[model samples]
Target: MSKSGDDQVRYEPAAPKKEQGGAQKPASQKSRPLLEYSPVYLLVTIMLTLFTAEWLIMIILNMAPGIPQEWATLINALALTVVIFPVVYFFHYRPKVRDLAELKRVSLVLTESERRIRSVMEATNDSIIQINEKGLIVFWNRAAEALFGYTAKEIMNKKFLTLVTSPRYYVFFEKWFRNELDLVKKNHGDSMGQGQFEVFIKRKNEKVIPVEVSLSSVWLEDSLHTICMVRDITIRKKAFVALKESEKRFREALEKVCMVTAQVEANGKIMFCNDYFLRVTGWEKKDVLGRNLFALFIADKFHAALKKRLYESIAMRVEIKQMEQEIITRSGDCRLVMFNTTNLLDHKGRVIGVTIIGEDITERKKSEEIKKESNERLRKANEELQKAQTQLVRSEKLASLGHLAAGVAHEIRNPLNIISTSIQLLSMEERLSPETVKTSRIVMEQVKRASKITENLREFAREKKPEIIKMDLHDFLERTIALVEYEMSLENITVVRNFNSGPIYLLGDEDQLAQVFLNVIGNARDSMNEKQEEFSYDELQKRGWVGQLVIETIVNEHMAGVRFRDTGVGVTRETKEKIYDPFYTTKREGKGTGLGLAIAYGIIENHGGRIEIESDVGEGAEFSVFLPLATERNA
Candidate 1:
């Protein structure tokens, strides 16, 4: 046996030598022969001894050969066999068989142990690896293969630190291993410890992943080695990062919103509040947190009802949307607010709290109240104005009737006097005489004049809406001028038309416009004739000016205009003001019923138009008529 009582051929750790209590261990030591105590050496020695014995038997048989040669050879072979059999059986064959049986048993035990270890390692989701004393990977499991994109054969004997992406972590692992080894050695063959650490590792494809490693050490064949159970935590890390980003976004949004947002516990305690909530309630976050929501912000009068509603909504999991309530601010001032509230749920979907989003509405409520009061005032004012307008219209109507009655009585009196004088003359004649005939003719003429006056009154009183149609103003005026052409020529009046070259289309009653034009032209002719009587013919001839009537058609953005200007005795200011009044005129008796200008005014007004007269006595008059031009919508 070896002096140390250990098999010299087996691998062993070099022991540290000591010289007394404080001696340093020696570094160099002589190595022992590897095959000195092997079973193979014993077998070889036994085989050599048997071979020498057979040689000796052969020699003896040759020396004592009195028998036959063949018999001697047979005896020699038997002796060799007899001697060799026992020697080989006892010294070599038996020992070899027993050793083989032990070896097979040990092999089966080792195979079963290895199978159980592999099964355990493969069953787990975590990657399992083992590294030797030199940091070389000695074992890699199925999970390790999937995690590192490597197979056992590919990674065996490869340095484990090669998979670590960070050099700092690699150095730390080496130092930690050395420390653990030193501790284990100092502990007299005891394991240092088991521990966990995080590190980034690179896969076969050069992709980096975060992993957690649980490390354990073992003494194998007198050498210390480490076993690592690594877990890929990349997905968990991503989830954590995403959760942090989502929280950041939520906080940013809450800070930017204008409405008050807060979370309240089921007991009405404020758990969380946004910046807007603190600002609106005039309270700091420290003052609001953990305070009772109803006792702090809600008015005392609304506290009971609001609490009841909140409890009901929580129990039913219902939302209260756009509900208005009065709240008391931190300054003790009441303000109206609208609140949208809903249940705040946990991960299990169970309602544990309430979320309130509220908007301040005090100013809006005040504005609505003020608007209601203003509307009431406006309604009363409108009623008073309507009454005043009604009284004014009635007074004006009465005055207008009085003037019309007076004018009619005066106009008919002249005609009636003419008829009465003519009748008296006829009665005095007594027989068929020239004076009687002349009186009959005068009576008929006055009767015709009265009838004409009645017709003019009928036309003036009749008020009918004009039949508006699209008509060209110039063409309509030309037709009216044709009707008044003979009258203008008899009065020695010249007519001048300055018409717009472009078509001046207007939506108006053609017949009504024609009558208006004819009346205005006839007025111009009469004005000239009245002035002619005042002037001597020789003086008029010396002036070298015939009565002139100018007609013009014009077009502009909004309206079409027609102007009739005359060189004659124009009207006074008073006459111009009353010119459009019904039954008012300046013509001699029996020459006019005084309804012409008024009739023209009514017709123009019905067509959504206007008339303006500019006149001065003995200077002639100008009449301008304006009508709204036809538009796409009007057409």
Candidate 2:
């Protein structure tokens, strides 16, 4: 780059940018004021001499005047006083006045220069500094203040050598700027902007700073002065550090995303590997970085393809697409990973390295296989039945997911309701009360959030309006039972039931009631799954239960009820109390959303009926649902 002065962004490992062949721009004039030395003293000397000459003339006048004796004596006294006063004033006061004037000029210039330098430095993203020949900081700009945390005033006139550790470099600077070097330069005539050097500087806080030092000989009043411009390259150094850290973090995160990332340099060096890669390949970082790309485990298995894709990426400077390959793990197990290669380019767009991203798609591939088998089994199962089983199973899966959405919404609603109510109540409090007012408002805001969640649950479940129909309750339970029968049988669950035959009728939504049956039955099935492996016959008998599940139905004059009893592991006392809440479930993580009973309760309430549940932790649970019979309907 073209430069009258070099910006200090030094580095030892990397060469500085070569000077570009371009038109040279004229160097701008330096803005700092010239230091005053002889001129100030000369001006003071001239003024004092003129004052003395006037005093002498006055003294001579007093000695030679023609006058009366008394008048002449008074004139001599006045003349002596005049001469003495002038002499005292010049000696004492006038010099002080000249010093004050010079000080004012110096201060004004310093203030103006400080302002300009501060403005430029703060405006720049980089830091600027000036170190004198003795390596003392004479000037520091505002950006330096921000970067190093030291103000100009804090370190001014202090030996700059103290800031830099190992002041041996000061020797190099001294020799470079000494009069011995200048004579050589003067003999050569007009040597400007030469012998520019780069070195790393340490900040006041001991941060390693990179800088470029430019030595320029400029004449100010016929004396040679060297002004070294220091630019701090902390940011560039930080970038280099960040890039390395990012590579490390990338490897760590990839372990979770389950990918193998490798960097291949120009000389075919395999620059990185993570835990999974090592576990799979029996190789460590020692076995990687700077090693030949094709020498690692399973290299021959993938070496040719990798080299081909690598060359393609490097040549094209674009990403190479997914390449499937297998590598033997350190455990002697082979895992499949789909690899992608990309070229890492420099500022000039030359490919300097290649980054390969490999994802272990083995699990995904296995999942696809399992899905195929499940699909075949499902197809066979469907063929053995009507559309009802297929529809019901799908609905149950969707319902399970919907339970999450609904529970979130239902829980949110209560809080949201609380918030809204609190906000309203707050306004009714005495006006302009900050604490009370703020709390109330915050409560309402939270209530609004809950309300939104409720709305979302409604949308997710497609549950907006209650649909009513008179339906046989037993028939509903029978269908839901059939839907889960295969799942229960797979777990070897025994179901017991006793039905008191009666002409029972209920006025309620058939599908919603069915939902209640499905939820209850599903919970019963889960409990059975839990106890299937852990319980013995003796333990089951102690719980007032014999097996996994029991279903019983009965009808009376007022209401028809179904008692769903499960011998599966039951709910805790606490769980029983909250069983009817919208989103409460205890089927373990990722299993239940705790919303089944809540929805069932809502449906029952809408039907002018109610639901109840009873549970014992080690024993089992029973859910009894009652629905009021329709007026005049047979019971």
Candidate 3:
């Protein structure tokens, strides 16, 4: 054939059709002619026409009957061959041959197209399948074979939906397929509309996998067929589920974490805050979001500095670790906070904002301060305890010495008494001279003084229990002062009494308590007398220096106190420490036994009372005696 003729019959795959608006439709293969005559039909028609023409020609020859049968048959054969053969060959046989050649070429084109389509479907990772109107599988690619674990030979003509879909989806799939078939038939299969869905499909091994299926309809011959592109989405589904779980855990951690956490923009605007942050700052989500962090929570005094520092840190992309500051709460209370900050970065590692974690340390600071104060108090208490311990040790020694002195006093008193009797007998002799009488008198005086010293030693050793009774403290002190009134007057000492308005009462032995008061009074008088001796009478008069012994009675809810304040030479610290020891005297020889204060100390201690001394050298001394009141003792 000619090149132009070959071109006319040549077939190429259809290009996509363009609509009026220039939109191109999907390319689809065109349908073949609706009425096409087959080879057998053409052969039958030609044979019948030849038979009718020859029969008429033979009848005409027979009607002549003049020539023999052989010549007549030859004539008939020649006419039929010459007249019908050319017409049949040219008008029918030749055209049919050309048609046969064209069909063969078209077949080759279709075969090549099919080969290319198959190659494309096999190359893709997604499974491609085609199902006919009967819902039977007609086409399956290599990907389909790998995906479903079923070879094309095995799966051909098999029911696709029934084999792959689970039983629970049977009704749904049936309805869906029916509707899709109706749609395809209504469009005459020209509309290659596609639908995509995710569904579970069972593999040949009976293991189910999640898959995404895309369906498009196509007309094959006269029947509508569905084309499916199946992609295994098992990994995608798992990744989606894992991502959701990770988000859930992250959200829960933010809500439940103890530290206050927030995200702020570089400009100090809050972007996000956790539940703990909202709770600590006493702010609602709507109120706090997008607000300035420093303006809302930091004090005015710290606002500028804190904001500047935060801006600097953000600009430099520096992380703050344990930076301490104060944050004001909604209630106008300040909380000490330690902050840790980290830069929040974008995908390109550029800083966008910051993440802040604040730890409240207010209580920790208060506890440390309290601990410091407690340590200081404990130190002072320890010192006071040590002083009391030393005083107790000294008292114990004095008591032991008293016991020894008492024994010695008892032995010496007997000899002094025997000597006194001998002296009385000797003095009774009439022949004795006046000198002897005087000498005996002097001996008696010395013996009497020694006896007094022994008496005081015996008294110091005595540990007599108090005869308890309730007595008016004022009257008791008054009576004791009256006993020393004459002696105080002889020493040119003036007594002053400052008594409480109400009667102060105490429970104690009257005699022992009286002895304590008298001893204190006598010491005061002696100290004043010694001070007065420092100035002669003329100098004392000229200076107007009068020795005063001020007695005061003080009362409290728990105790009754008597204060003896004297204008006398005061005791030194060293002297005060040993002042209450037996025989520890500052008086001249033969003047004092020094047992007075010691006995008084024992008596006051036994009465559940105490004596406190306050004195300075040359500033005189004040001795306060405190005894439990009657009401306090009874209670």
Candidate 4:
């Protein structure tokens, strides 16, 4: 007998039927019979028939009245022996011999099948055990012996449940076994008797182990028996526990990390978020998870672009590194965040989602902006300080020059008076010729020019403070322009007035400001005249060279400004440095004393005003005079 595919026991003939001399019988010799004859029935029938025949023979011999009794008995014995012998040989002995041979063949087949089954039970890794209906262990294979540390001789015929199950599980094992047996009986050893369960079993050394047991029941030699396949499960249980522990630790670490972290689906829905993410965004976990990432955290203005970037990264299976973005917090404040993203992939390397790590950089960005502003302010302050320093140095140089001019003017004045007296006396002589008188007049003119130069030097050295009063700057400029109007027209210079519509009131001395304006106009007129002289009449016409003096008044929050723009050959860079120095001139001989601009600069400084010059050699020049507004000074 052997187990089939469905685990059902079956038996097959070990060898086919053979004829005499161990040769297989031919197909022609094999035939089906209409009736099967039993040896016992044949023997009984033959005996009955022989007995009747002997009785009949005895009767016949008696009826025949044989001549001699001995002859009749011998004849009867011979007939009966011959008939009985043939019938028994053909009917009983022959069939019995054939039946015995068939029984031997069946016994050989059963022995071979049993041997094969035993070998299979011994070779399998799982422990195989057999228990009878009485709860006694009937079979123990080699694996069972190794697993339980018991030999077959020691464990056989022992109570399996008592020996293998712990005391605490005795009742359970007994109850379970009883139920299984009942179920097997009810189903007549059907597949319903087979099942599997896990349990803790004790070995012979009293060590306990986890095991999985598969049970099956079958009828063996007219008795119910259960076969158990036991497998050790200690390693599997340990590995499962280890995996759970690792997962728990990973989750804890994610929650406690310092940076924001989140898992988002490809569609932009947030799946998981760590504690830091919620803390930074000022959102609760319940409110954040499963919400759309863009809608919840990203501003409306950035929603479309951020969503597009996210989808594109996922589609391309690429990571996003160091992307700066601004997020809206729960309190309606905006925060700058730096994010790094990685794609989450499945086992097949297909994109499933994305993981993002973000760092809040709002404070850092603010600090950078503040530092940049501080640097800009510092630069402007340094420029202003340099300008002040330059002004101070220039002021010191002018102060020394002023003292020198005062001394020179005093020394030259005495000589100029003496020369004037002499020239006048010479002109008074009675016999003076016309030629002599002309020469005397010329000498007087020269002496008077010298006197004017000395007077200018004295004025330049004077440190008189201006008498401050509120005055309309526009009116003051118009008066100053009136003084030079004739001179400018004679040179064909156009005076373009661009004054403000409203009056600009400033605090400055009328006389001092007028002098400053006259000096600046004089310089502009001379520069244009010089430019005109550079070309002839026809050349000037061809070049379209026209002298223009553009005067404009500008008012700001705290100052009133007057600008003088000239279409003239502008000052050179070398000339601009010494332009405000006393006795320095870029004019022809006898044209100017050059004390005019020096005096103008000192008066403007005393009035708490500044003069700024902007010029390029060929481009023309602009002079802007700025003074504090009367209202600003009072305030």
Against the true structure, whose lDDT is highest?
Answer: 4
Candidate 2: 10-residue stretch with minimal lDDT: 9-18
- Identify the runs in model 3 with alpha carbons over 4 angstroms from their true place: 1-330, 334-384, 537-544, 632-635
Off by more than 4 A, model 2: 1-172, 175-225, 232-248, 255-257, 297-305, 326-336, 342-351, 360-635
TM-scores for all predictions: 0.34, 0.31, 0.44, 0.49
Higher-lDDT candidate of 3 and 4 = 4
Which of 3 and 4 is the better model by TM-score?
A: 4
Task: List model 4 lDDT by residue over 1-635, tens digit each.
Answer: 33455433343432343444556444222222313577787677778877877886787787888548787778777878877776657754666676667767767777787778778988999999888777787778889889989987778778888655657556756676688767655554442467788888889999888888888876665456778899988998787689679858966887889888899999888988999888888999999989988888888899888888988999988899999999888998888989999898775789999999889888999999999999999999999999799889879988888788899999999988988888888877899899999999889888889889888888887888889899988878878899889888988899999999998888999998888998899899988888888766468768787779999999867879999999888988888888887779999999998888888988888888888888999767999888999986473
lDDT of 4 at 2: 34
User: In model 1, what is the error at residue 89, expressed in angstroms?
Assistant: 99
* lDDT of candidate 1 over 497-572, digit per residue (tens): 8998888889988778888888888888888888888896568878875788998988756999988899888999
Local accuracy of candidate 3 as per-residue lDDT tens digits, 111-162:
7986687678779888988877777787787898999999877787788886
Q: Candidate 3 — worst ten consecutive residues by lDDT sum? A: 1-10
- What clash count goes with each model? 4, 12, 0, 0
Give the Å error, residue 397, model 3: 2.1
Per-residue alpha-carbon lDDT of candidate 2 for residues 476-574, written as tens digits (9 for 90 to 100): 666778887776767767667677676555777777777778877887877877785676656766866555577888876687888888876778877
How many clashes (backbone atoms < 3 Å, residues ≥3 apart in a chain or on different chains) does model 3 have?
0
Candidate 3 lDDT (Cα, 0 to 1): 0.81
